[model samples]
Target: MKQATAKVSHRLRGAQGGMEGRFRLVLVVVMAGVTLFVLGRGLFEAPDAPDTFVNGTSTSPGGHRALLHLLDEEGFTVTSSVDRLDVLNENDFQDPEAALALLEPSPQFLDKYESEVRGLFSRSWRPPLILVLPKRHYHALQSDEDGTLVLQEGIYSIDDSERVLQLAGLGSELGVRRVTGGDVIEPDSPYATRIHDESDEAQVLEFTSAASPWRKLITDSRNRTLAAVNPLTRVVVLAEPDLISNRFLDQGDSAALARHVFEASQCRHLVVDEALHGMATRASLEYLAVRPPALWALLSVLLLLALFAWREATVLRTQPAEVDARRSREFVIEGVARLMLRAKDFRMAAQHLQQRAPLALLPSRAHVHAAGVAGSTSASLPGEVAERLHQLPENDGSEEHLIRVARRVAEIRREVSLSHHVPSARKPG
Candidate 1:
């Protein structure tokens, strides 16, 4: 009956162990599935497009959104486009309103839209026009002799370059060699503000290149003064497009500087040369774009993660230390004796002896030694202390001698305490 009951208990224990093993297996499988799903999603998902526009709107930079927000805040309706005729028809060429025109570098926009652009200034009733010309498309516009592209009699161009259209000398010289490579415009130049890369100073401005016939109206060391204001139209020409781009909106006092130009001109209409839009978009997109990570770097990270998981699953148990009975007592006695010798403090040694060997009477031996009674050596100290001094205990002699030294030190202390005035006699010669 007892054997049958024991067998039943063993069977129950086996069943419980099997259930625990299956539970652990299920947990591991679930974790593995989750990891695979996450990794697969990261690998399959498409990359995000570059953030060219701020707040996800406004085609060109120059705080276009902020500018629109500002206008809306001030109760003004803001409109945008590349067509000059639409601008004129909206305002009926009669009401004086402010308009800003953004231009691209397209040949069709420059060649076909010339007549419409001219008609904007034909009527006496016109709005103020703000022109944005980037270096890439500056050469597409037609200009007259003296290197000046005059929009009206009062408004004209001042500077021109082969690489980028110079608008009032706002950018670095085209084809100028840099130590690191590429022509870099100086960021500190009055005409050029908010330089993007110091290594390659590609100036983003509203001016055209020399290939185009845009004329120059102003020239100075700091900035090329272009197009004198028509006193009536209040037209203003800016050299760098970055003056209004989102990236430069907060750079180098650009926001305040642009605001000053706008408020100072008092023009209701802004004419953007659509030819410069492509260049500006390309530049802005390039600034915001980031390079993808290398494949080797990704693989290395995955490999390290796999190695850690494998180590966790296959960890080994460390063995416990073995006990040695024979060496244990010898180790303790040797350790104590070495400490006493190193310290050279006999009083501390005596205290240690009393604590370790309570069965040995060391106090009686110390009293006999202090009395200076000859032939009373048998009772001069404890048997343990005497056996140690004479080295009579064979393998245990070292421990005995250590105890004897401690007893003698205690006796010397007693003698010094007992005699207050008498100088202690020296050991016999």
Candidate 2:
């Protein structure tokens, strides 16, 4: 028993070390690929760039393209709000014709357009306002050829979410709270399962504020509300953005929950915010690749690879025999021909010999035309070559038969080369 346990432990240790080494190799390859991609992006980038935020212009894990497409497919006319609050006020809102989707606005945006936001949302006669909170800070990576910035793998942060609540006048009734150390979202109620967490890596949203009179739409496993609605104000807040985001909409019941939220807005027309995500400037390759930690990590990986290579070169070995420094093209061709013959690929060897055959064996195009016997003249070089290949006898396709066919093709090429005035490729020059 002791011996068996010891062997098992030893094997486990070896497997663990092998896994670690494989992980390191994969990481190094990924880093090298990313470096090449960034360099290439920098070289061939366009001047203008597109917006890849929740602006419905992208289908990346971070963007809201899926939601927009779903809404459109469901027969709802979804429009985009690229301008500031001026466009909101210009629309007919008293009859609830449109629902405004305020998606992941930066604190800077809230501060700049605070009054405009208040004016639109605070109105008693306005459409339903849906606030989708931001949970992370993302740096735009590559841009499409048409110049659209792609957002992915952002660093998670819960900062400034409260500021968004304050801007929308919900700071008093509800607060934005974050709970770390949480993985999947579990629901407390049946309706809450509509926005269920299927992903193990799903982020959690907690409410720090005292319980308000607002109706809870969804909650975390701890029964803390993640989504709520205030019927009086006609305002709805979704604490977690991934429920409607491209990343998790198709996961679990997210799509159904998202549609339910939109239907609750009670508006036929919808407007998604794009101006808040900073689409004013184009994203450059330098912006994506020139980060301090990333640069350091890449440099460290490269240094490690170089050290490994150097260590490998330090091993002692028998001195290799030196050969002639130069060789003619004919010598290289002959060597390749010999390798093909050894492989027993008769067809390939014959085709190669045919390609290298002299051009002079075939009658000139001008001479063929001058003869004025065009209908009878099937003696073109390509025609004759095809005929020669066709004339090759069928066999059981054994290695011996293949070798015979190759030899015959080689002889034909040699005869054609001798008949041609063209400089022979096989000649020792």
Q: Candidates' lDDT values, in order?
A: 0.43, 0.63
- Model 2 residue runs over 4 Å out of place are 1-52, 87-89, 92-95, 142-152, 180-211, 279-429
How many clashes does the backbone of model 2 have? 3
lDDT of 1 by residue, 1-429 (tens): 856866676677678766865775676667667656655655664433232232113433422566545444544545544334534346433445555544222333334444544555454655665554433221223667788543321111222221222221323322211121122222343443434454633332233355533333332223443222333445555444444555566665555555544544564444333322322222222222222344455456557666755765687634322234324788879988898688776555544654454234333444545656433333434444444434422223354555665666466446434542233346889
lDDT of 2 by residue, 336-393 (tens): 8888668886555445544554342454556545544343223465566556755766
Candidate 1, poorest ten consecutive residues by summed lDDT: 175-184
Model 1's TM-score against the true structure: 0.31
List candidate 1 segments past 4 Å from native. 1-63, 70-76, 81-87, 90-94, 100-108, 121-125, 136-193, 196-233, 268-429
**Model 2: ten consecutive residues of lowest lDDT:** 317-326
Best by lDDT: 2
* lDDT of model 1, residue 162: 19
lDDT of 2 at 407: 68
Evaluate candidate 2 by giving its C-alpha RMSD to the native, one decimal: 26.9
